[model samples]
Target: MADHAGHCSSSSQDRRSHFLVAAYGYQGHLNPALALARRLARPHGGGARVTLSVAASAHARMFPSSPPGQLVVAPPDAEVSDGIISYVPYSDGFDFGARPRTAADRARRRRVSAASLSAIVRRLAAAGRPVTCVVSALLLPAADVAVEHGIPLAVFWNQSAATLAAYYHYFHGHEHLVAAAAAAYVGGADDPASVTLPGLPPLRVRDLPSFLVDATGGEHARASIDSMRALLEIVGREKPMVLVNTIDMLEPEAVALRAMRQQHLEVFAVGPMLPRLQLLQQTDAAGDDEGRRIDLYEQDDEKGYTEWLDARPRRSVVYVSYGSMLGYSRQQVQEMLRGLRECRRPYLWVVPRDGRDGDVERCLMEMDDDDGDGERGMVMEWCDQLKVLAHPSTGCFVTHCGWNSMLEALVFGVPMVAVPNWSDQPVNAHLVEELGVGVRAERDAAGLLVGTELAKFIAVVTGDGDEGMNIRNRASFWNQIL
Candidate 1:
């Protein structure tokens, strides 16, 4: 195994493998990408070096104390080790703050990032440690940059293999079918019927990615669709070996279709990439040395959430969280609060400070005061979510169905009540329902979750009912497999 002190040895240094990993700026995308990068860089006979590259704006958020830059290595507050993994920040046009709004802005940022990443690859090659291969996480431009540097490219599919197959078919053969269905549904303004892809399970129109079914998403949706198509097209031409965050036994059909050479692609199921929690059980052969979690936001649990959780009975607490980016309307917030109150379960909720903190804080205060027993529910800005999920008290997770969150829920054997907002979340919700691991909460036509429906599903999933028992058993079954 290689250590920081071994950097001085010539033979040991010569044997080190180097991989350049690039991920999009979003938190969901970065978490999986970095986790994979860490796994690749774990201690071994021959050492490994990983370079995590991200857009400048995201870099700033990850390490807010770092100075502005074009292409810089080891910015202040970057979590880097001497001989293991390192951080490299790149320009995405919007370096200071905010994401690309329009297609032109997105394209411009891609161009800038491509040039900067090419430079990083060149710099590494110039230094005696050439990058062996480039693994990109949802940032399609990184593939072109890797090719330009005369290196092999592997796309890290940040979502599930099922979603991968859906996109794969969309670009290969099912484009017209999906487009026509979406158009017809849009015209009728009726609930969309389920659509089937080649060699895959049937998916409701709502189960498909929002970019495919919802035209009202405007420029963002169109841009996302274009990027997804472009990514598949690139893979078909380049024939790069793809890596997905799923296992073979879990989604056999999707994995088989993914590796079909007839489509000029080969895919590998290499993940469920997660933080190996030493407290519960160890998954990797690396023992309990899982190291620090890769977090963009600093988590300060001033409320002692872990202590609160420690006092709860086993499998008694409900954990609720939307992902990093999703925010709720005030009405929806009240509905969730009402549902939690009605469910009569001990709960821990994460309420982010995205303009509605005051409302959420007030709600939490009211809920706390109304409790005859102390602290029926706890709310914090953020905490170590993976740790919370791994806790014994965590029985159910109320999730946004983001792929990372779903993967964690599966790992921890926690059933979910999915509240899908947009993007791939709806597809993941469909997967949760299809897999029979959990049930989706019912929503109205406008896509708002009803309080009574939320409370009812919570009772059904958490109570001793037959359906709840089945879901719980399936969740425990997957946890053992994972």
Candidate 2:
């Protein structure tokens, strides 16, 4: 293995390099890649020219240039799954925190488009920083470019490793099983049933997200899944590595799964990266604070939900968000709105307005409950999530169980109500429920939200229920430097 440090050159005459990251235009993908780009672009000693190439329109807003690293627009060819960040402000809780939905045809067209990656790379090459390593974020075109340039490629798991492993296994000749299990998964109309993977422990059919298999009953899904499978299978052929954006302690199963498959595919769990990234931002905040405030939000929303915690008691508000990319049905969204209304508890909900479909403001106005206690609710399209989790006023979290959101919850030691939307959320939800950090909620077909389940969820989150709290408390305390 070649030491990466050996690639680090000090001579100013030598052309500098940029960590070319493919973020695929979603918050989940772009956010992490941006953080990494920022990390790599940071100077070690005194002087070093650097660049951090990002692929989002919001980059200029969120990451203003005091550090002066490069912020490239996500190009056309860079388009992975979907090409555009919908006008839908990437809100939380609404559609399980996903970017707004678009037609499959447009998505397919965008996926095959060749405008972004090459242009960005060409720009970097033009900027005197020949692109070095390529990092792909599912849709981000890093892998394709990596193959083109013969540079090392690292596929970033924007979600959790558990789902990554499951999807990886899907491509490794589990097509029939995936197809069958996917049918059963699509059969959400029936009673929830368990389906087992060959190398995995038993999991419910509902545990698998529909997107992992061929939902179209066509080659695109199969080919896409197969492509990902082929990518994972042969990643080690060139001693390529897989980077799981979680800490070792957060998910042992994902870590174990990676080890089982191959040795050359090294798994480095260097996160929960956002927290560390935020911590780094704070470290750098003392002087350059004025120019680089975190941007990319409605002006008023700069005030975070957790800021309320400054006055309230510790762990008081239930912080709720479903990450930035989990899709949800309309019924599910309404259920959460109504359930929170009934729960009568103070909460902070990152509910994105339907930027395209309808007036999200209408949805908010319609769900208006005169609970009277300003404490009962705080809703927004998006929130500065980490600040909310880290706030002392946050007592509990209700989430769709995206690994990033889940780990952030756990890292902050907040108790949880886990709603496994799709992907590895089921596994993470079970881990949380079984381990005592959180509890799962029941759902119905159409995937609509249920209040009775929400009642149980509320009880569990509020400490009015059973043994779950003991686990959460221990986890919380463990996080307190113990």
Candidate 3:
């Protein structure tokens, strides 16, 4: 086995391996896939060459200054390398980040992406750099391309193993049971029934992945359930190896791995899949290469945020951010502001102007105008979350409980006030509480996490009380172990 320092012997075959990681264009999907690509490109991780593939829209966003040809639709052989991993873009039939309005539009994206990826594979092989494996981050078309090309495939499960287990059982043999439980709960059942899957703890209906029980049946909800079903179907038919983004110590029982392998599926827990500061230092020592971290959105000035944190007292600032893909309503945002003001804590909050709602922009502008000199609060469209969490002044995280955010909070030893919204966030929030590292705030009947509840949970996580101390201690323990 290779040590943390990448000191391990590799076979000649390992050195010749080239991994093509095809990631979905979303922020949550891109982060872990990029992290894994970086790891595989390292000397300790088989010293393999890696190529990251995403839609042209995301590629253009990440490298906006690239030439027009590269931004629109990259040539089959066009690739950018940051002295380590290579990045290539494939057209997903929606280069401007437009969502598909119909099923046919969705299918067109898959077809276009598949064709572009296949071209890239052939082009690489023609240049004597054939991809030895394909690792997909929920990009379904990548699986078809790999199969068509006869290359080994692996799916990167970018959520907790527990959620993976829930999805597995929900598809395998427990669909009826889960559906019944969810329906009953939604119908105001007093019991709020629990589901006991093999090799795992009993999970309440609320703890399951939100897509499974969402009553809205909106397009997004339907699309989510369909995506999960297709992914599971591929798992069952192809039995490709799975690389989960979770720590073994965190999931001691390994319920997902056990359940999958019982039917001959291969799964590996390869995580704390975060950027290593030491690795960044090493990169710095080599040169001024700056592509180690990739973000789809432009970030706030690093010096400005770090300087603000440096001036604050140790363990005093509250860092609040909902992950990308979640846009809080104007009322919710106002309530959050009220809670932050009432808490009387210095805070840093991220509110991205994704241009989806004009009201949100007006609210954010109002907030900026109110906090003139940023003495009590600072608002950024987006900021480097890992840097803020790693700062000593950051005492607690008020987050949407995205898996990447949860992993960052845990690894940085920061307690959390989980305000999960949808998808796997609810499951991640449940695990946060189960791990004793955070408190999940209770929401009102309309699923609004109002000001009082938010303020109370913030205090519970960062206060001097016994519960706060225990949560902080557990967070520290996990941090050390990782």
Candidates in order, TM-scores: namely 0.88, 0.76, 0.93
Off by over 4 Å in 3: 1-14, 66-73, 191-193, 280-291
> Candidate 3: what lDDT?
0.83
Candidate 3 per-residue lDDT, tens place, 404-471, comes to 99998998899999988888998889889989999999889988889988889999998999999999
Error of 3 at 361 (Å): 2.6
Q: Each prediction's Cα lDDT score?
A: 0.77, 0.56, 0.83
Best by TM-score: 3
How does model 2 score by TM-score? 0.76
Please give the lDDT score at residue 419 for candidate 3: 87
Off by over 4 Å in 1: 1-16, 43-47, 60-79, 187-194, 258-260, 279-291, 355-374
Q: lDDT per residue, candidate 2, 1-482, as tens digits? A: 02231143212223244345555544555556555544444454212233333434554434343343444433222322111111111111121213423345334433442244556667657757566666565643456566766665666666666676677666656657766766765666452445555445666555664457435555444445545665565564544556677655555655667443554455565455454434635655764321122334443254544455576776667777776555445555567767876766677777654331355455555554454444567666776676677677877788888776776677677788888765567767876765577778877855666866785677666764457568567567636621
Model 1: worst 10 consecutive residues (lDDT sum): 1-10
lDDT tens per residue, model 1, 270-319: 78777655532453344443544556555757358888999999999989
Error of 1 at 286 (Å): 12
Candidate 1 clashing pairs?
none
Of 1 and 2, the candidate ahead on lDDT is 1
Highest-scoring model, lDDT = 3
